[model samples]
Target: MPVEMKVLMNHIYEYQKGVRRMVLFTFNQKYEPAVVDRMRRLQLPFLLQPVGNGCLNLYFGRRECLDAVRMIVDKPLSRLTPEEDFILGAMLGYDLCAQCERYCERKCRRGHCGAAGA
Candidate 1:
């Protein structure tokens, strides 16, 4: 799927308007410094929560922040684990995994072994 950079920027802008802090998740360790610097420059308070296997969670101070994020990122809100979905909805006002494509063997965008044939 094509990523809409403009929409993403808008999401970020909207999120910043309502939140004091945000969380960012990344799969690339190399992107940590740069991403953090950018976030700081944007004046958005953020916490970097790193997960195993390059997953990074960006926590926002308000649910509105996540609503903006969902508008820009083309992921489905329904696909997220229940816990994650609830947190996102309650805190961010939107879900990020609703339309997200499942990682299958042949269609895995992350290229995981389990998705090799999906």
Candidate 2:
């Protein structure tokens, strides 16, 4: 996914209101201090969607869905596992995974995970 695409998609969804925003932060296997700071700074309502293979989704305001797009487009491949990266890319509207890959892909689609792949 490209940054331009992210911005464009976000612009389109920006008008929708009252929708709960979830931020999915995709992280590396190791915790990064900066990400913690970013999460703390987020003022809007949010829920953390952590990817098992180094990725997370930070849900925020109704319009914050765009942030998902932003994360996919902005984050580099080196930051996440192939599967996690593929899942994040899919979330941002870029489907890199073939149908078969879905089996291994992280379960971000469910919006949250209480147990492994839940």
Candidate 3:
């Protein structure tokens, strides 16, 4: 089932308050039409991607941010490149330090990190 309306409203409230540039929610595919209708009524910009198993990932926020996401990410969210992951995290208002740490870890794991003290 999709999340409670109150939960979705809380995310919407944060967006309206300018506290978040982007937000994501996972919902059953069955809810897509209703969710899309609501977003249209509110004139909110959004992107919806199917995530298998009758689930969808709904991303809503600034139009430019959504556009950038569309351009940068062509694969599943779980398969995002480190830079793509970093960009998404930053745009979602995640902690910068944590995002940075996560990016560095991902790069290191991929053997793309530069040698220490180089």
The digit string of per-residue lDDT tens for model 1 on 44-82 reads 655555555765555444446656555544344435544
Stretches of candidate 1 exceeding 4 Å from the true structure: 1-10, 17-27, 62-85, 95-118
**lDDT to native, each model:** 0.49, 0.46, 0.88
| Candidate with more favorable, higher TM-score: 1 or 3 | 3
TM-score for each candidate, following the candidate numbering: 0.42, 0.28, 0.90
Candidate 1 versus the native: TM-score? 0.42
Q: lDDT at 91 for candidate 1?
A: 50
Q: Which structure is stronger by TM-score: 1 or 2?
A: 1
**Candidate 3 segments whose C-alpha is farther than 4 A from its true place:** none
| Ranking of all predicted structures according to lDDT, beginning with the best and ending with the worst | 3, 1, 2
TM-score of structure candidate 2: 0.28
Predicted structure 3: lDDT = 0.88
- The alpha-carbon lDDT assigned to residue 92 of candidate 1 equals 44
Tens digits of per-residue lDDT for model 2, 1-118: 4453354236335423423133344445344444445445643444455555665544344445555545654544456654556655454444454622653544445444335573
Highest TM-score against the true fold, candidate:
3
Report clashes for each candidate as comma-separated counts. Answer: 26, 17, 0
Tens digits of per-residue lDDT for model 3 on 38-112? 889999999998889998888999999999989977889889999999999998889999999999999999999
